[model samples]
Structures are given as C-alpha cells and as structure tokens.
Target: MTWTDDDPGQGEPPAILGLAKLRTARAQEIRRAQDTLTTASGDAGVGWQAQSQTAFAAEVQKTAGDVELLAVGMEKQAAVLTQYAGQLSQLKDRQRILEQRRASAKSSLARANAMMPGGLFSEPTPAPFVLAGEEDSTAEAKAEEEARQRAAAESKIAAAQADLRAIESEWDALVADRRRVDQSCSTALEAADILGAVSSFSGSAVSAASPGDLLDRLSVLSAIDLQVLLAAHPELAEKLQAASTQDVATWWNALDAEHQQTFIVGLPNIIGSLNGVSALGRVAANRINAANRLEAIERTLADWKRQAAQPGSFTNATSQISALEDEIKYLRGAVSEPPTVQLYLYDKDADRIIEMIGTPSPETKRVVTYTPGTLANLDGFYSGDTQSIADWLHKRDEDGMVAFVVKDGRYPQNPLTEANDQQYARGIAQNLADFEEVAFTDPLLEGRQSVAIGHSWGVANITVSEALGAHYDKVVSLSGAGAPADWTPSPTTEYRDFSYDDILQFAQDIRVGEHGAVWSGRNPREVGFAHEDYYDAPLTWKSFPGNGLVNPLLAAAGGIESHNLAASTAPGNLTLLNDMRDFINEAGAPR
Candidate 1:
C-alpha cells in the first residue's frame, strides 16, 4: 500500500494483506513460466535441432532465474510491508482501547454527577433534607462525603483525558513510522525490478554498470535511511570516505532542508566530523549539538537541586549546580546571536572550542586565529581580550578585512607545569590545520594572508600546530612559555615577543638553564626568528601626554605587569601596541 499523510487506510493491515496476495500471485506466475520453459524444451527435436533447442533452453533458464530472484525480492518486500501493517494495526487497537476507557470514564462521571445531588448542574441536594430532631452533624458529614465523591469523579475524568492525549500522540508516531516503512519497501521493490531486468540482459551490459549510480540514488534517501543503507554496505561507506570535501559538501547540500536537519539531529557526530562538509554546515550541526548538551546539563542541575537538601550533600550539590549553570550560561551566550557563518567545531566530551568568534568568508583578506593560554575560556575570550586584538589589527590595516578567531585550545589547569607538555598542543594544532584548510577554500580567499598568534602557552600551541602542517603567512609567539626542542617554525615570518620585566620570562630562563631548554625546549629567539623585547620598548602615557611623572610610574607598573600589559591596550602599553602593529603590517605587506 502507498502511504500518504492524507490516507489513513493505505497503511492499514487490509491494504498490506492485499499487497501480500499480489506478490504471491507474481511469484506463482514466475513458477508457471519456469514450468512452461521446461515443457517447451522437452518439445524440441533430437540431433542437430536438439543442440539449438539446448541453447534456447539455457537462455530461458537464465531468464527464469532472474524472474525467480525478482519474485523472492517481492516476497520479502511483501513480508516487511505486512509486518509494518501489523504494527500499525496493534497501535490502532491500543488507541481504541484507550478511547473505550475514556468513554467509560465519561459515563461514570455522568452517573456520579447525576446521583450526587448535583443533577449534572446543580449543587448537592441540601444534605438529603435533615428530618426533625436529626443531628446537624450527620447532615454536615453527608455533605462532606458527597464533595469527596465529586472530587474523585473529576479526577477520573482528568486522568482519562490525559490517557487519551498520550494515545493520540502514540498513534501519530505510528502513522509516521508506517509511512517511512512503506517508502523503504517501495524503494526495494523498484530496485528489485531494475536488477531483474538487468540480470536478463546478455553479454557485458550487467558487468559494465557501476555501483556509483546506486550510491548516488541513496543520496535522496532520508539521513536515517542512508545510515541504514551504509551500515548494510560497507563498500558504500568506503566510497563516502574517499569522497572529496567539495563532493561531500555538494552531496550534503543536495538533500532537502528537512533531511539535512534530520541528519544534523540524528548523526551529529558523523556530520560534524566530516572534513569535506562545509564549515557552515558543520557549524549549524554543532550548534544544535551544543544546545542539546546545554539542555542535558540543565536537566542534571535540576536533579542535583532536588537532592540538595540531603544531609552532607548540600555543599557538593551546590558547587556542581553552580558549575553547570555557569556552563549553560556560557553556551547560551555563545550560540545566541551567532554570525551568519557560525562554525562550531566544539567537542563536548573534550570541552574544545570554548569560544570561536567571527566568520570565515571568501572576502576575507586576512585571517588571524588567536589561542589563549592558562585558565582561558569562553569567559576570557569575551572579556575584551579577543576583541581588543581584532580592533588593533583592523585599526592598523583599514584596507583589508580580517576574520579574527579566538580559540581556547583546552589549556591545562596548571600553566606553569603543563605548558611544556606537547600532548596538550597536538589536538589543537590539528584542529587549527583543519580549520585553515576548510576556511580558506573559497576562491576569494586565495593567497590571502593567514596568521596564528598565541599568547603565553598559546604560543606553544601555535608552534605545535605549525609543526603539524598548519600553513600561515605569519606566526606570532607573544610571551611564549616554550616549545619542543625539535620544533621548527613553519610560517614564512615568525615573530617572538618577550617582556624583560615579565616574571614568566625570568622563570622560563631559570627553568631553561636548569633543564637546558625552555618549557617547549626550543626558545624562538635562539632559532632564526625575529624578536620583540616589549620590556625594553619605550612606554608612554598617551592619555596623559604631558604628565612626565605619570609616564614613568606607568612605565614601571607596565614593567611589573609586562606579561599581560604588553598584550593590553592600556595607555602605558601604547608603545607595545605600536610595535605589534608595525610587526603585523610589515609581515602582511605584499612581498
């Protein structure tokens, strides 16, 4: 039976039973044809005529075999259809039972209304007319009993209505399932017919047909169905794996919007991880995933709140509840008011991409991705640090548009001890490379200058990403902790920043002397990279142009806060910003 939204009867058992009968008849016809072919072969003459007859019989047998296969496929399709129909029938029966129960409830409620002195509309009959000398207490007790009965009747009615609603919802779901199953069966039947026809062909026609066409046909299927098809055909999965990024994007975009949304919802892990899919598409899917995660966290927080009053559990619950709430708050803000091309490469299991800002587009002339280190997260990225850098770059170069990104590379809890670990930088570097590849594919961004800037341990991340094959025109290691001893800069131009008064630098120098290497083991200055000593750079009170005393005091303070102040836009650190601007301009300038 062909199922459609408007045709309830088509998905019923009777229609499916009829389909089964038709399939059985078709199978019988195929058997009859086989018998007829055998009889015709028997009627052929002997000797020279027998040889011709034998060849004819062989061709007939092959055709009969094709028909038999088709019949078998049809029978299987019929069985599946019957099974789905039976499921629908059972659901309908359950719905009928629910309706019956609801009707019974209504009848009971009516009877109670009629007998409880209410007459369906009036108040309780005056407590059954208290007789002369009858105790008033007895009459009051009767009235209370009548009120209780009325309440019980109302409760029964409400419960029945709720049950009916649930049944209706289930019935709707059943109908949807029936429709999907019917579509799948129909597709199988069509395929069987085509295969049967192809098998009947002689020579190389069958062998010449490529499975690519069949795989392409599945592109029109629902995401869930496609997944089922792939699971059944590992070869198809291999084909998909071999597809190019552009090919993947094209295939993904060809699906209807509804199916695309379904894929995003049903298989986010798959869609989000595919490198060939457009970043915009991945972002769309990832945002949904993030929202789902937030919902789950909120649900857990609610559970925790329910158990918060237990003895000795209040403090722990409160702390966990606060953390969950904060996470939800951050997620909501990140997903809200997203850019036109918001890409979410976040992995909830790893809590990656704490924040990624701005959109990558073809029109972008320059892309600058910043990695923050040590306790840096969504909160830190949104707290002016990311925007200040973007603003500085934009102010420096007004002729070109820049896409500024703030990537939180899952920094370790202890920056001092963990900054040297190469493991932490590995994943971030790979992700950076992938992001660059996907983001720069647009023709408009061809040959555009791309830069990776890391602050503190972030520099180590940038260095590792470069070592891992992230191609950028320039790399900025601002106040870097260190990198691997074997690591080499990958960018065409590499710039290193070290503030002399920076306490981290002093610690790093001492650590290098003790360990014979910086945290990463290789200091950028020791290598063939340009260096900027922000500590020695002159400081000026731009806000207070004539305050001589204020400038020196501010400069002294800048030295003490040099580690962070160098990256800051404070008046005392104006020289540091100027130096950064010059470095970027020179590096980004046409060669």
Candidate 2:
C-alpha cells in the first residue's frame, strides 16, 4: 500500500502525467463553452436588443473572455506538467535499467564464487625440488581461469553498484527540479487568481453581486429548484465563502446570538475556515468538517480496495486507496491529540491547512506561528514533525503563548528551488495576515507580543507576509533565504537571522523567480545578507561544553550543518538551542 514514486516498478507510473491530461481535457471543454458564448453573443442584434438586453450581452462577452483566460491558464499548466512528467519518466527508466544491471552483476558474482579453488581438476602440486614436468598442468590452468572469473565478477559488480548510486543521485535532483517547475507553474496560475476557475467554467455559477443578492435570488426558488441550483453553485449557498474575513466577521457579529449559533451549525465549513471568526466557533465548525470528510474518504477507500481485489483490474487502485488512507489518518489523528490543539482550517483537496497548539484567548500573551519551507505536504499533517515543534514551542510559554504551524498549500520542496519568489509567499502571507486578524484582535491578546518564525523557505514567507500587512513584533530566520533584495521591513519588526555552515545558500540562483531574488550564492557567515543580519558566529559555539582535550579546530569543524540547525536545536546540544533559549526570553514567546 506504500505509494512511492522514488522506487521504480514498486508503484504506479507517475500520476502527474495523468493529471496534466485531465487539465488539458478540462481546458478543451472550457474552450468549447467560450466558443458557444461568443457565437450566441454574435447571433443577437441591436434591432431587438433593449438596454437591458445589450448589458446582458456585454456581460456574456466579458464572462466569455474570463473563461477563455482560464482555459489558457489550464492549457499552460498542462503543458508544463507534461514536460515535467517526461523528465520524471526518463529518470524512472534510467533507474530501472541500472537496477537490472545490478541484479545481473550480483548473479554473476554468486556464480563466480561457486567455482571452487580446486574444482573438478585437482591434483597434488610437486615441490620445487621435484620434477617440474610432472606438475599438474590441468590444475594450474583451472586455477588461472578461476582467478580471472573472480576478478571479472568484482569489476562488473563495482560498475553496476556505481551506476545504481548515480541513479539515486539523479532521483534527488529530479525531486528538486520538480519543485522548481511546480512552483513556477502554480505561481503563474495563482497570479492570474484562477481559484476554482475550471469549476466556475464547468457549469458552476459565480455571482457578480454581493452575498445578499445571491441569497435573495435563492430565497424564492422552489425546494427542488433550490437543491439543483445549490448543487451546481455551492459557493452561492454559503454567503460567507466569497466575502472578506473582515466583512464575514462583521456580519457574523451583527447576527443575534441565536442566529449566530444557527449559522455555526448550518455552515460549519464556511464558519470554521474563516479568519476573524471566533476561536471556539472555528474549532466546533472544523471538527464537524473533519468528521464528515473522514467518513466520506473512508467510504471511497473501501470502494477502491474492493475494485483492486478483482482479477485483472488495475492494481494501481492501491495507490489511490493508499492516498485516501493517509488523508483519513491525518483527519482522525486530531481526536488523539491534546484537546487544546485546534483544527483551525483543513482543506484537504486544496492542500492547505492550519493547526493551532493552544487557545488564542484574552489571557494569551504571546503567539508564535511557524511556516515550513519545502519538503512538506498535507498528507503528513498529523503524523509529522510539525506537531513536535508546536509542542516544543508551546511548552516554552505554557500559560500565555499559542503556537501555530501553517502549511499554506503546496510549497517548493527543494532548497535549490529558490523560494524568494513573491508569488510563492503571497498566498502564505495572506493567510498569516488573516490569522493575525482572527487570532489576536481580541482585548488583551491584541497588545500581546507576536513572533513569527521561519525555517528555510518560511523565512521568505514571513517577510512577504509582513510586507502584505501581517504584523509581528519579532521574526526569527533559521537558515532561511531572505525576501526580495530591495524589500525593506518596518522598524517595528525586529529581525533575527541564524545560519550555520549551510551550503544551500550557494545554489540559490539555480532556479529563481522572475524577480531574480537569490541567496547571494555565498556562505552567510562570510558575505552576510545585504538586507538582514547573520548571527551564527556568536550564537553557535566553536567548541561544545565537554570537549576537554579535543582539538579546538577539529571540534569547530564538527559543528552542525545548516539544515539541522534550522530544523530543531532541541537535542544533541546543537548550536541552535542556545539561540532558541535566548529567543524564548528575548521575544517573550516560544514555539
């Protein structure tokens, strides 16, 4: 049931290629719809067209243009994914070939070893003094042949093993490249603001007016008609779905106590996922959402398993079922966690999620929110290191601080991907901004200390969020790349950047955003950042506490690497822990 893409022949072929084809099909469908709209607009004439009719025709043309733009974006996305899938297919093929060679070499080595030193042709050897002509010529010949066979086997084995290692290295490179291409393609679509664009074009309606107007339109419909319309346009059914957080919060507050309770129960998905909504209300809403989603995924998983068991059926159904199982595991894991852990937001399909470690109440004095860099996914939400880190941060200030770990959709999984792209950070920044409004706008918590921590790519996300109006009193960067080169932070936001002898800084320019923001391609300790400070020398100890007689130079050289120091400094007495303790005191927050 392990759906691994890293091992060739172990799982299904790359599903990414299939996804690209699906997008292409959707684009074709949208293109056809756009053609129909354009043709209908052309068929209508000014002779019978009243003022309202003309306006309606113009709106139709506008919607057609929007649909056309969406179709183009999807086509572009499909093309990029297709190219990426081709590259992955090549890598997979190369891996399989090398594995076959390794297997053959191993078999050859085994056969060579089975040839005994004195096989079939064995005889007593004559001493030097004895008659040399009487020596066993057959034995000598057999020994020579056996020696050659052994040497040849060793040579072949070495070559095969080396080739296999090379393939593994290529696999790592592919993972990195996949992230770069994925981020670039996704950034373009996100910049176009094509959220649910395909759905909007594929018969789902989007209202041009306010939520109230949408409700008014729906209120008069018969029960049967309402059900059909709502099925097609669920976005319209939840009035709060399209509104800004501020507006939703205001509207929710204006409702009487009884009505607010009714809305929380009626539309838990919308109420729970909204920022600026009450903390407890969201927890209640999100719990219901998670339960419902988990139940549905379980049902689908059972069906997939049943299909997979049938003879001659696509065994690849196992991969699909395994993915659903992961989602279910993550969903149900919340029940086992501490009661304080809040399911702030969970959109499994979109791959965006937020989790809070504790209650964000008036008594809360400090808040620490962590945004991960790369190599993270929603599938591992509950069982990942994020919860461990959250617990660590929470323990730092048990009474006052609330810690949040956010995975704001998909992130570029490679450090070489160069996540300084504003596009990559923009969505995360918006989420952080909304989280701040929702978490800290209360009486005492509003004035409390807010700290934002970023490790690796998260550093860029935090800074971009700051630029986008996510206010934080302190920011800590752990081996993270900086934001845009020319971008400046407000004087109110204190920045603390930490970097060990990290080598990722050297590969920053390999794949960068259009803005071309890079990591300066030099050691942070030497060149230092053009914008932020590098404080590794003072915080990181040259020699640890108990290094009694060890060579000072050797001990210094044995220091931790950049990624480890950035990840967690809790154990092994690494250099980063000292800084973390200082930060816990300095920022008056932890986690």
Best by lDDT: 2
Give per-residue CA lDDT, model 1, range 146-242, as digits (tens).
7876787667656656766765676577567666665665455446342333222222322343433443554454443443343434454344455
Would you estimate the TM-scores of all the predictions?
0.52, 0.53
CA lDDT, every prediction? 0.60, 0.61
Task: Quote model 2's TM-score.
Answer: 0.53
Clashing pairs for model 1 are 245-276, 483-520
Error of 1 at 54 (Å): 67
Candidate 1 differs from the real structure by a C-alpha RMSD in angstroms, to one decimal, of 21.7
Give a tens-digit lDDT track for model 2, residues 350-422: 7788887777676887777888776767654656665555567677665587777888677766544436455
